[model samples]
Target: MARCFDGNKLVIASHNKGKVREIGELLAPFGVETVSAGDLGLPEPIEDGLTFIANAEIKALAAAKAANLPALADDSGLEVDALDGDPGIYSARWAGPKKDFTVGMEKIHALIKDQDNMAANFTCALTLAWPDGHMESFEGKVFGTLTWPLRGDKGFGYDPMFIPNGHAVTFAEMEPADKHAMSHRADAFKQLIAACFGDNQ
Candidate 1:
């Protein structure tokens, strides 16, 4: 059986406000008291991992050890098929140090080939680490196509331009609750919940 989360306190090992907020909401129903790494002033560790889960694990472990609490970390990004996943793990870096995704979005648009095959996907890797070093990881994805003239202002990241399959509007066009229902992060969270938090849910 997967290790179950039996603690009431959890540290969200991320500085991104969007991720921290979203994760906190997901954990709310379980009655977990959440604190962000940013709130604790935890330094951002080097994400030297080669893949999403590796990075997630790195962050989770770092925060878990530092906070002496269970830590949950997420590493996610958009992958463009035609571009051969150009910015998969480097998604955040593409935004530059200022975290300006608009610049990253424009760069993606400029590099797209065969606009008709603008196939892409948002990928997420979620990892939970304990201070003792044990860990659990889960991953999820949402397939979609790239859209231009980025729409809506509701979501952060590349949400303004990516439309999920069978959806008319970009992720940013949907309400927060709506996006949470089907986002890549939510997908990963579902698995994490089912495996480690099923009893609580």
Candidate 2:
């Protein structure tokens, strides 16, 4: 059995505005009030973890401890098969300090431009931590291929270049609600909902 989240307020442990907004939208149906770590002035902990789940837990626990409230965190990245996942965990770091996804995409394109295999995927790990030290976690992935010249002007990060399987348009080209419906984060959120909310979802 998993620990239930009966709390009304949660701290979203993320500095990325887009992530905060997406998560806030996901949690809306649960009627939970969300406050971002940035808003609360919580310091971002070093993501020294080896995996997405580890990093998510680290951030969630850090915020839960600091705020004395339940905290939710997500660590997501793009993994390219051709590069042997070179930027798997370092996806954000590849974007540089300014968090420029354009630079990140350009680097990826440079590496795999000549290669025939442009296969790639997105991975997301979500962690929920309570003030009492209990924690729950989930993970999700969306398989896709890389596109050239970068399409679309929506979605943050490397969305413009990722074309999910069976989809003609990139994530950056889809509506927010449409992307959310089939995103890796949404897959993980479904598992979290199953574990915490049971059938109520």
Residue-level lDDT of model 2, residues 1-201, one tens digit each, is: 988888889999999999999999999998889999999999999999999999999999999999999999999999999999868889999999999999999999999999999999999999999977789999999999999999998898999999999999999999999999999999999999999976455
In each prediction, how many residue pairs overlap at the backbone (N, C-alpha, C within less than 3 A)? 0, 0
lDDT measured at residue 167 in model 1 versus the true structure, 0 to 100 = 93
What do the candidate models score in CA lDDT, each in turn? 0.95, 0.94
Residues 11-108, candidate 1, lDDT per residue (tens digit)?
A: 99999998899999888989999999999999999999999999999999999999999999999999999889879999999999999999999999
After superposing candidate 2 on the true structure, give the runs of residues whose Cα lies further than 4 Å from its correct spot.
Answer: none
* TM-score, model 1 to reference: 0.98
In model 2, what lDDT does residue 168 have? 96
State the weakest 10-residue window (summed lDDT) of model 2. Answer: 192-201
State residue 157's C-alpha deviation in candidate 1, in Å.
Answer: 0.6
Residue pair clashes in candidate 2: none
